[model samples]
Target: MAVSALVHLVTGGLVVGGALLIVLGWETIVQPVLGLFLIFLAAELRPRFGKVDEERLLRRAGVPRLFALLDDIAEAVGTRGFDAVRLTQDFAISAVPFGLRRRRLDIGLALWETLTPQQRIACPARARGHFAAGDVRHNLMVRTALPP
Candidate 1:
């Protein structure tokens, strides 16, 4: 993604510079290089410039939404326990499974401030592991928790 962004920026600069050169009647090998740079830039950037289809899915679902989602997630897993969730960064979120069977969903600042010591330790591992694994689904769980 970073490469794509860099290419796009460089290519865009070259295209603009090339156009300006043309307008000034400055015909030189540089113009073609600039133009080619732009094409190459676009090609390199194309992959990163695509639309993000996961925005809705990535959204924090908020407290109410989380409640509903976690409720379902926990129930699905047959755990009476749930996890406390948080949005750790711009790109992803985290959650730590809790409860007997870990079927329940805790959310928001209020719940976060009230986690037990064990929950706090366990939460971050879950969230971080999920993020490292590139699983957006795990992002919904609490990766960190507050101390009791």
Candidate 2:
């Protein structure tokens, strides 16, 4: 099994075991109430489907050079390309994967415009690496399971 799945299993088991100990060891009336609350909390933690705004999708921009740079960077990182590019105001570049097979290359317009050609290529390259590596921080399930 994958290490990611194993981590989740261990975490889930620990939580459930702790809850069972609390329910079984405690003889107070609130024990059942706390158990029910834990159940509801667990139920609420199911990963939800992600939705992207179609309006933010980039069909084409006037900057051919930027697009070419993007193509080169993507090739360097071994990804086919982004399905869509989403412009953001956050001043950070990231790859956002939504649904099953769709990915959005999130470009922070403020930072993109300020970066040098080489820096622009570098930033996206790291984001691509994150997406490609199945990094824990980049996994939606892992992200959702942890507390913010």
Candidate 3:
């Protein structure tokens, strides 16, 4: 996925460069208009990067026990601790990268409400597995480069 993102970036760069050369080499109105269109295309393909708002998410300070469980899971999986834990309405758990090395874990309230304690542990364990496999970085790259 990182490779894909790099490819997209390079392609965007080439498009913009070629467009600029075309506009500069030719004085025609059509050439400048085409260059502007290519520039727009490059902007659209550029990755969208952002950080998760930890303030809005349920923090460990507010729910120590839950974070402790997550800590245990992280230890068991041999992965680093999560940056934050968030509650959501969806019936799924997700580990999302915020920036370079920051990862936030999102737990669905509906899923937590339905599952037993053991089952709840499994959710994050599986999410941690992605990190354990060392694919989180690539996953983040793909996610950032692609449009939803």
Model 2 agreement with the true structure over 1-148: per-residue lDDT tens digits: 2654665665566568558856695778677667666656655654444678888787446556656776787888887566678889988999877766666688998999999988878988888887667677657665544443
Model 2 steric clash total: 0
Worst 10 residues of 1 by lDDT: 139-148
Tell me the tens digit of each residue's lDDT in model 3 across 1-148: 6577686777678687758867695767777777777777777676666556656776778889878988999999999878788778889998877666677888888888999978888989999888888874536666677563
lDDT for each residue of candidate 1 in 110-135, tens digit (9 for 90 to 100): 54566786675455445444434555
Clashing pairs in 3: none
Question: Which portions of model 3 miss their true places by more than 4 Å?
Answer: 2-6, 50-55, 136-138
**Clashes per model (N, Cα, C within 3 A):** 16, 0, 0
Clashing pairs in 2: none
Off by over 4 Å in 1: 1-12, 25-43, 46-51, 54-148
lDDT of 3 at 114: 93
Q: What ranking emerges by lDDT with the best candidate at the front?
A: 3, 2, 1
TM-score of 3: 0.79
